[model samples]
Target: MNVTFRCPPELEQVLPRPVPAKVGLPDWLRRMPATAHDEVLGVELMTVKKCAPFLDAMGYGFLMPLACDLQIDKGRLSWDWDLPATPGETYSRSPVALHAAAQVRGSPFEKGAAPMLKFNAFWTIELPAGWSLLCTHPVNRTDLPFRSLTGMVDSDRYTDNFINFVAEWIDPSFSGILPRGTPVAQCIPVRRESFDYRFEVMTQDETDAFRDTRDSMDGTAGVYRRDMRVRK
Candidate 1:
């Protein structure tokens, strides 16, 4: 609970505060769940309880935003990554480092998948013991121009450096401003725990309890709010 974010003086001035995913929602989307379509081909998006999943995903973790403005010109795949935090600071290297898809190996991404670009990071986090940080693209944020790769860091132990965002540029023709404070990654603290691979089925008591819980939740919402979820 005592996790802390540390930044260089230059970065501290411009770094967007890490915020709950709910704050990232555009006004239109935040209202869609109540004001629009209720079902799509029998599946729901607007008002059904299932839509809560989307809301939940969009409200669960903290989003880390880009510290500066990144302007890209598709014609040459070049950029001017600039920040107001440190005026007159020279960007010797483009903040967006474009790596040819063909040059990368040892990952699930296929050859020629897309040109990969990495966002240089200026923030580092210090979490307490027995914890790790899961860094990846913001959940349900596929609308962005890039797809950031997932990474897990033992922030409690690795304190020497910052973590950057590694993403595959998804839209090749996109140009112009990727404005400052754009959420680039989501970080969630995960406690280190033991795991076993053996499988098992639910007992009769569990099956009955599951049905009871499902029926209760179906009849009324807030099952988790009322009886299950523990507040942080």
Candidate 2:
């Protein structure tokens, strides 16, 4: 599916454009050992770096990056940008905005925390008809100091304005600068649909198939990767 990302001409030269998630895989993932020795098992065990499913999940979509560098001191956030405004067009000048704590009162993110932050988006996303954008935190990025709240936008229909991201400030003591182009949201296009649910017990044949698959996987690395995984 073709997706469009539009921004002001002034921002086109300054702001970081979204990137393919696979191209933005975190440094930790690349540095991790594929297999580590396990003293308890007396053998080497494959780590998440060698897990196709885990790696695929992290590389499944596009990454929305920070428009500018944001400095976070204690719990405060600030940025420095000299953006030129568009004639007769209004948009965010900063990289982030604020959401009053009262807006999330009684919610899990509240917890007496200071105001939540809304990431000021510079681009407007456009998707093909019948498809929506699922915006969530970077997959498996627990190292980040903030936790992005998940949201869904029907980009197929709503493409006029920015789809900003709201996040809870998770680490008050974290003091550092989040550089420009740091991924703030991972977006996946989803088709609009409804589905019915079913619960069932496996038939004898299904059970046998399951056993066969499990047996093939046991004590064997890359069984699923070699035989079942679909290459992209």
> Which candidate comes out best when scored by lDDT?
2
Given candidate 2, what's the lDDT at residue 212?
Answer: 91
Per-candidate local distance difference test: 0.71, 0.89
lDDT for each residue of candidate 2 in 1-232, tens digit (9 for 90 to 100)? 8999998887788889999999999999999999999999898889999899998889988999998899888677788888876788677687998899999998888867578888888889999999999999999998888889999999999998988999987878889999898888999999999999999999999999999999989968799899999864
RMSD of each: 3.9, 1.3
Kindly state the number of residue pairs that clash in model 2: 0
Best by TM-score: 2
Error of 1 at 113 (Å): 8.7
List model 1 lDDT by residue over 105-167, tens digit each.
767654456667777766678899999999988887777888888899999988657777888
TM-score attained by model 2:
0.95
